[model samples]
Target chain A: MLKKGIKYTVALILLLIVGYNSVYIKKLSEVKAAAATGKFDATLYAQTFWQEKLTPGLAKANNLPELLTLLKSDKENAFKNYSHALGIGNLRYFLIKGIGKITASNENDISVTLLPDSVGQEVKLATEFVYGNAVRDALGILSINDFSNTMDMNNVSAEINKKIRTEIIPPFRAQAKKSDVVAFTGAIELNQVHLRLDEIEVIPVSLNLIQK
Target chain B: MSPKVFVKEEKAQVQPPTLKAPAFSGSYSRYLVKFQSLIALFILCLIISLLSDKFLTVANGWNVMRQISVNICISVGMTLVVLTAGIDLSVGSVLALCGAITAGLLKFGIELPSQDLFIGFTLLGVVLAGLLTGTLLGTFNGWTITRFKVPPFVATLAVLTIARGLTMLYTKGFPISGLGADFAYIGTGWLLGIPVPVWISGIIVGLAVFLTNKTRLGRYIYAIGGNESAARLSGINISKVKTTVYAIAGGLAAIGGIIVTSRLDSAQPNAGISYELDAIAAVVIGGTSLSGGRGSILGTVQGAIIIGVLNNGLVLLNVSPFWQQVVKGMVILLAVIIDKANSKSE
Candidate 1:
């Protein structure tokens, strides 16, 4: 009799789980349907992320000069404090703001010399092609788990990169001259082992020319 | 004393008549249990084929085979471990670590102290490195279990965490990518129009079958699982047999890791997360006794295929991934229940 009771309890629990799963599946299907029909808007999500999260979060970003100093002194601690990774095996992303003059300019990258002109520290602001998960993961605000699948998560990243290309990069490229003092906030990705401290490539979120 | 022995003999003779019916049923149920997984596989395939038009196609058949190849490799090793009444939770973590090591070796060749003796990343070197890493880790698990009297579960569980942590540290929590074409061929390349992984798994299954059926060590493994004290009394080196079994399991897991890494062309530190569960489920669903001394490699192969087909068919039918998890759990439970009923009859 006890065995029968235990079996019944297990069955009941399984049924409850199945029922709960069915509801989750229903909700997921609805989301999938929206995705299929192109109703789920990644561009809109990216826009909201830019205005509400990325721009607002810039104030909390690590200062470039300070971060470089920390990186030089202690690499691991600097990563722990400044960089963000969405999960294990993911590249670490950092949101950084700096006041720098464009020391070198090219079609691809604009080299910036951080203020007080430290000799070996150079930051390259990417003006041509913005790639990778830097902008999406840098602020550590957008989570992949929030999306339905990796494809959707990736779509958000693509949209964010597109936003950087269209709105952020064009104006900065048009008005800015070489050696112009500029204040910039951007996201940079780094592999832990290879620091590449000599040249830090950044995907700019916002860049403005400042009068010295 | 003679009179008492005679009386007992008479009683034993008398018991046969009463025991005859149950004896017949026991043998019948044993046979039923033996073929149970195979029957289930056939039925599952039928159901899936009926449900989806794409299921029975040659292309999809090959696709399913390729998909299950890695699981089959792991499950084959898992079958041996289960037969010895042991479990290796470290297989998944070992896979990740080995994959990372292999990818790292390929991407960044090791520098030897002697300037001229640098060991550049050759395909052979990377493969050996991955296999050696797995074997060493498995040996450690076996050694801990035997030498320290640590339970297999606890020992392997510890190794699981250690290996995964090591993998994270080695890769610095980033994926190692761009393994050259020679290494990629092991996973993605085809032989006679079948995937290379499928070929590798087939060879492993063949070798495992021979090892389990035709070797003295295999017999010892079964014996130890059947009754440890009896086997020990019978002059079996239980420690050696058990250790060897675990090492084989670890090596096979490394092969699975290599295949996964080659297929993706990248070794993610988080590769093979929770893979141990899938492998354990496959072993159980294959009709292997969790208590040990009973199971076959073919059953595990079938079980892995069943899972692969279920996954494929569900996607074809547009079933949600969440529902697939639910269904897989239900199937495993049902298989175990059936196994229990069969064993009870015996």
Candidate 2:
């Protein structure tokens, strides 16, 4: 009887271990699936998982899109978030792709190219395509998916507010500059873009001409 | 009973001739734990390298080292704290607070760039600032743990939330920027083809190793960890030792914060969240007993590298971030289970 009891206990333990392993495998598989899809609905998953499992205060406090950016920036952070909310792991792939340009070709529908700028490397649109009668407006559509996520929308609005009020509007209003504009585009617009500078250093030049 | 009968009875029990054998048993067990952990770390690193081409790159290797340095520094101190059966969850938040203060000082030039904020003076002042802040916070934790008899886990957990909240209030939700080029150099620069953060971490690890192996204080730490009541009976100053251990932990965590801020060139008030767990994980993987009294600095360094390689390799392979977490959790769980089995055998 004792031997039989021991066998039963061992079997139970093995079953528990297998169950745990199965759950882990499932979570990992889900994360991988979500990461593969560029347009997966991360917000829905984040909200649902948070509501069902995570602490309510934490769920409500975290700004999902900003947190998504933070996770993609570092692997350790990504793993840490994935361990907590698997939804974060799924969103990070899209977040990184978003940071760079996403290109669509005839066969290769999406590719991203990095460009070196004054500040740092930035993703620029490579395709010459226009949407809704505007060439520059096409860039706006790329970020529209980002805005569709409510959490990301909040971050964008906050950044735009900060730039408009604390940066652009103050200087423009002070100098009475009328033509300054802020546009979100994937590529540079030749004629429509306005240049704004906080300070400029001028160099003096001498030109000598002889007339006959 | 006859002498022959007594001898036969003792032989039947397989009793050793002396108690010294069991005394030596503990050391042997410790050695086994260390060996097993080293083997695990070796296998982990090997697997990661084979799986990802990017893992073996010189630049990526340096980046991994640079990335793990801060966490390792904190783990070195954390190992000591945990050895005394205590914890410091506030390390992460403390790191942010220190970074914020340091960057805030730099932004306004509270000290003049050349005159007052020369390398020697500025660096010294920053170190002192970190030390003071860390020590005070650690001392606060130690005091509550000792005086109020609070559990290390609960007390430190409370401090973690409080410190993070204070950081947000202090920074008003924006990162502190405009640090000096000199300050930024610590994070980005290299010495002898190695990043400064890596060099600094190496020095810190060496110091911890020396302290643990070659000092009387180190002996007491193990003694306290092995058995607190017995250690107190032996006349070790329990409260003082505990306080000092936690203070050192805080100071070490502060150094990590300094390194991170320098690298980013700005101090994000919210940076370093969940850092305590990484430090603890590294310490445990290195074969440190969570219950305290058994660990080594060298082991912790190896553990840190294992985690660093895992992170870097996964990114290089472009493994879905979700799966990476699953893998990490499994590794940690396995390590812990192995550690427990080894402990029981000892």
Candidate 3:
């Protein structure tokens, strides 16, 4: 009886030890996945984030008119309703995907103002609305808490932005002929309140020339 | 008396001592298996603790328990099946299928009139759907094995592919997320400073120990496994016991699935791919003979911890995941080889 008691105690202790190790492993893996800065594929990361987070969030979002009403009625509530953040609302992210034309460009920034295909009768889209890095900042899809430390996230975002600038712009800029139609899926921030009704700058994660 | 007997050795014609087999009631070497798994677990704990300071900490202690909860849930059921000398290869796939179904059902809610009461019922429905899917698929595996006279390996392997395919088809190979905070609570929430999955699995282990030790079905399972012909001669329902075991395995797999989905907050169709192997290894390591009729859930519990510790320790040491797989394979091989040697001696 004494021997059996000892054995059971040992087994119990063993299980407890094993269980503790399990916790350590889980926390370590979480830290590991979040801390990775430069080693993974950027396109894959961006694409997955776009598809998994941005697209779904956008699909569930209210339309422009409905959103405008919400904004007017309750700006805080509107932001609360529309916003999603990895860190319990640290930074907000939004998605805007539709057909539009590039009405203007900044040669230095390679940035473009998009005229959305559909225009409201009385309201025009904003001109001050910038899409690219500014949109990236507002969307806050790649926040540090769920992903990385602030520094690592900045570095990764910079790399992704660079990949977009060097690879995406040269081909896109060469084909920017008159009367060209471009379809874009991009991200935007809700805080850009002073934008023209017809003008919105979208950071094109994927941009295409519909016709030239 | 001993001196007199020694002096009488010549008179007794130098009688040799008879070798008595180590016994459990009447069985030979019965306690060997009980000790072997315990010793293995002890060795694992010793090695891990010595190598890493992180191994013996309190926070990690709960972490291991929480992480191994799903593994325990699955392996406990596996212990029964392996004792019957049958295997459930489709358990991982069943987990994926059940998890996907559970999440999908939550998303595929009925157009309820009210939000408050309806959410409660809908959640209940989701849990039932997950369990039912697991049970039904497990039943199919049992049916093929018993009725069609198909081998357990081939039948479960086929089911693995079929269920996995169905899981992917159901979700278009994408993970289903947004399962709600309430759904997540079952896995991630702590009732009393312990993770919920740990509580869930602990209850399952208690129930399993009771069922196998105290129930008629348990006796029939062992009897059938020990000697199928003798069990049949004694009028034991072999097919029924076998089917029930598989069914229980399936239901248990679903429990694992739901726990994983809740923990991850999503159900990827690809989730649980090859998880069955780990569960099987745990059973085998627990000193359960793969040859049937001889294993206990208690041993499997230790076996699972052994594996969990090894994986955990290796990672804490900064070992590569690739090397971890190799070590796991070796552990399984070493366990089976020892089992073979022990069986030979028996």
- The TM-scores of all predictions, comma-separated, are 0.62, 0.59, 0.62
TM-score of the second chain of model 1 compared to its true counterpart: 0.90
lDDT of 2 at B186: 80
| Candidate 3 residue-wise lDDT, B254-345, digit = tens | 99999999998789889998789999999998888887898888888888888888888888787878999999999999999998988887
Q: Best-fitting candidate, measured by TM-score?
A: 3
lDDT of 2 by residue, B12-119 (tens): 578664556766976787666658767776786788778876666788878899999998989998999988877789899988987877766554324333332312
Reference-based lDDT, each prediction:
0.86, 0.63, 0.74
Chain B: TM-scores of all predictions: 0.90, 0.87, 0.89
| Ten-residue region with minimum lDDT total, candidate 2 chain A | A200-209
A33-91 per-residue lDDT for model 1 (tens digits): 55479545788888888889888899998888898898889999989888997878536
Report how far residue B15 has shifted in candidate 3, in Å: 8.9
Docking class of 2: incorrect
Cα displacement (Å) at residue B95, model 3: 0.2
TM-score of chain A of each: 0.80, 0.23, 0.51
Model 3 residue A187 lDDT score: 49
Q: Which pairs clash inside model 2?
A: A104-A109
